[model samples]
Target: MPIQPQAAKYKPESPILSLGEKIGDPVHAADFPKAILRFRNDRWAEAVGLDHLNDDQWVQHFGRFQPLEGTLQQPLALRYHGHQFRVYNPDIGDGRGFLFAQLRDHAGRLLDLGTKGSGQTPYSRFGDGRLTLKGGVREILATEMLEALGVNSSKTFSLVETGEDLIRGDEPSPTRSSVLVRLSHSHIRIGTFQRIALEQNSELMTRLVDYCLTNLLQPAPEGVAPPIALMRQAVENTAELAASFMVAGFVHGVLNSDNINITGESFDYGPWRFTPHWEPGFTAAYFDQTGLYAFGRQAEAIHWDVAQLAVSLRLLCEAEPLIAELEHFPALYQDSLITHFFRRIGLTPGEREASLQFIESCVQAMAQTGTEIDRFFFDWRCGDPRSPARYAGEAWDKVRMEAAAFLPAGTRDHPYWTDDAPCSMHIEEVEALWSAIADRDDWEPLNQKVEAIRRMGEAHQPRLT
Candidate 1:
């Protein structure tokens, strides 16, 4: 087995249960005709102390939802409510997924093993809980690409193709189905808090708030209220998430409260897309008719989403400090955007004013000159310390000249930097990759894409913020 062993041993815990019955209900995994393991993440498995399991053991635990030795005895289908594209839905939760297990990684940080297509619960409503195989594949691709690009995204821990044929309106009928397992910092979303606030359960809200501050963050400062401190941490995190997405050219299709993890890590990849260039109005989900969560508006969208989180927190404390924290989002996002933009282009933060001007100029240039997103960054890797110096010749010379003043932060020695073309994962290319899997059961293209993406990550040296 390929593994990246860490120093700390496996540690299991279920602190969410401390919130008790209000959060969720236990549910059994679906009975499938077959369980074929397609993807296994030994790197993360080792971190969580499951890398020792053989493939059969892996499928038994993940595919069949057998309880991990010391985790949740039964899967908990979490309950929460959220605004779906600005419309509130009180009856929305983990419809096709559930929290399967909770444990600490090698770094001693709490991580939840959640599912995407394991089965249905109270939230399934009118649909089958099965995830189409294509959807599973797409998620793997999305998470892999996002991680490679240095986005703090959920890890696609395992993907197993469960034998089943499901019908759907979105694509071809009777599509293949599968189950996906992901590892992330926390499953408690803003919607989770919103659900409590809706119930007007102040006691439970306080309990949940304490759970977050204790498990997700440190103790509140001497004078700081718990809600205010938690809100501040969340504000910084969500701002960083928005900045990472924008700089990576990612459009998260859905920016609902439920999809926003309170831990600030990006999760739930649906209707996601990478922009061809810097178009602020670009959208990922087709149903987003108003462009509420467009690429350019993501920072605003997250601010709005977190403000709702602050509203949820209002049930437990005074609104002034919470509102104050929400107000910090704009400055937090701009500073974070500038920070990540420099990291993305392999340069240091030269000077705040100069860096801001250069970034604005680059964004404007990319828009006016229609420069491809990855191409622009690829050409300037290590500020063209090596080959691939294909930046705009004269029109952008001043910007390039300014970039030269900053010391290089990323090395161009990786073989990937010498390639004729940058690693790209456009929708067109992804669909073509899926066609190969569907038509000929050829997995090489998808595998190759994952490898190439990892190589690109090696070249960029992605560091999670």
Candidate 2:
């Protein structure tokens, strides 16, 4: 058994915890007088102030979603391996996190609600599974911010400031620790399946595949063989995810196999950021010196990760079918990227090819000019093409001039292409900062932009070609 020695230690406790209880059905908001847990003058300690929480309080705050009908919430440690920076590190696993169990959300979606800083498990090899407050805040921002941007991502359901003190080597001495509860489709990753595949445990692999298919994918035809179908489905989901990241200016920071999910939703917001400028070599990870997972290389990185999954599955079946599915990645990602990019600029399917070409050219020019990424699109939502030309401040006029020269010959005819009127927003350097699009915080302006863009999207036509 190649399974890590401690792998078998993790198993769900008695009276399996269901997802329903965790979400707190018949949900009642906690009242001010209820005397709820509070972060001691600090949120990190107050959120998970389990010591202060009585049995009833725990039930009230976390009980409805607890799934288990008891005092102990037994966390299960998972086993898996991953390739960090293109190098295989079999010693890896949850090493820290645990699946609290699945939860059915208000929408009747089976969401896996897990905690990153719950506690140390067998896989916590030399490191604390505890999460810092900084990480907690970042994850919250990611979930709320990215969702508003129309990107599919794991949501931060709750941040229980575990009320405990932690010592993280990265930050200031004695970093505050808190539990970040994330709600997602499933916590299982490509690494989970890979582990079984590596062991050549076809039986376990088959069971795992079936589980993923039934839980992650929809009802399949009765007679269809699931393993191969599961692989194909994984390819499609992963490809779509890759495309979303590519078009959204998101660099996942880490594309490790353990981080990839069968559900294809973007989860685990670690060191993630929208590229500030269009440097193909820009990466979110501090340690990513070679930029293996750079902004422009995300598509390729994901494809490479998927290819690893494909090879791992080779033990159970021929490689050709898997290769075929993998081969479809580029096109799938391209279509997704184009769709997202079109939406960003309010392009619909009915738009003429020339119009789109103009938009693409404008985007390239803005990015090349090192313009902020988010504000540019947000400004475009108001139907301004030559808006950049009206910018009044220093250095901006130069960029505006460049934009004009970059515009295609007939772009002036477009309704948004202004010649006479200046850009409506103030011409301050702060305003200039917004024009580049990337500088605007992903949380702000993005939600408003999504709504306004949707309206334009209604009238908009996309590329017929």
lDDT of 1 by residue, 1-465 (tens): 012236456788998899988889999999989999989878778888888889999999889989888789999999899998888999899999999999998867888999999888999999798899998888889888888888888989999999899999979988899999999888989999999999999999888889888987777889988889889999999999999998899999999999999988899887889999999899988889999999999998899999999999999888988998899998898898888888888888877888888788788777878888898888777665234254545647766777777887877788987788889888999899999989998989988898888778777774744
Question: Candidate 1, 21: how far from true, in Å?
Answer: 1.2
Per-residue lDDT for 159-227 in model 2, tens only? 554445677666565654556667677777777767767677787666666666666676545774666
Q: Candidate 2: count the clashes.
A: 32
- Minimum summed lDDT over a 10-residue window in model 1 is located at 1-10
User: TM-score of model 1 relative to the true fold?
Assistant: 0.96
Task: Estimate candidate 1's RMSD in Å.
Answer: 2.1
Show where candidate 1 strays beyond 4 Å.
1-8, 385-390, 462-464
